[model samples]
Target: MAGVGSEKVFENDKVIVWNFVLEPGEETPVHTHEHSYMWYAIEGAPLHIYDKDGADLGIFEVPTGAVYSLKCQDGYLEVLSEIGKGARVPATHKARNDGDRPYREVLVEYKDAMPAGGSV
Candidate 1:
């Protein structure tokens, strides 16, 4: 299966770190997030989203230096903080850079925080 990010930068028993980068007009492969994860944006951009079936979701703004934590189960994701509390979306999806500059982020997935019976 494809990873959730562009590249696997590091991994240990507790977590995996990824360096995700998207050039202008580039898109990632449809991927799944099975464990809880967090990401820090290095560069900001508007990202167009598509579900696993290639259905368009919408454009999401990613602000530089922003961070987000999410929990996943059965291909659905829930925001872990109060800022976007009660919101959930499909976890199996792809992101396309819809801006002129490259978008970059550092993502970390918590292996220990996986839902019961979950595996990467």
Candidate 2:
């Protein structure tokens, strides 16, 4: 796998923050996310998503300062169950900058939490 061009700026019990940057024509290597996350685009541009096999998924128009959130495919119960059973799985994907300018964003990742009622 290649490397992701991002740095961990902060982390705490509740969340982890990352400072992501990518120059024009640059790309992020295949990466996985174990927790839910949202991103605020500092300098957005067109981007292309690709699979692990290098197949193009699609292109997206990212607007400057736009914010977006994504939930892990595994639900809360699934995550806990996987942990309990000693299984680790993460959502994987790769991204490429297709625009002329650099792309930057602040990514905030949420920590795992139990249900409010203490049950699934």
By TM-score, the best candidate is 1
Q: What does the lDDT read for residue 1 in candidate 2?
A: 14
Off by over 4 Å in 1: 82-85, 114-120
TM-score of each: 0.85, 0.76
Candidate 2 minimal-lDDT segment of 10 residues: 76-85
Native-vs-model 1 lDDT?
0.80
Model 1 residue 76 CA deviation in Å: 0.4
Among residues 3 or more apart in sequence or in different chains, the pairs in candidate 1 whose N, CA or C atoms overlap within 3 Å are none
lDDT of 2 by residue, 1-43 (tens): 1146388888899888888898999888888766666677899
List where candidate 2 sits over 4 angstroms from the true fold: 1-5, 75-90, 113-120
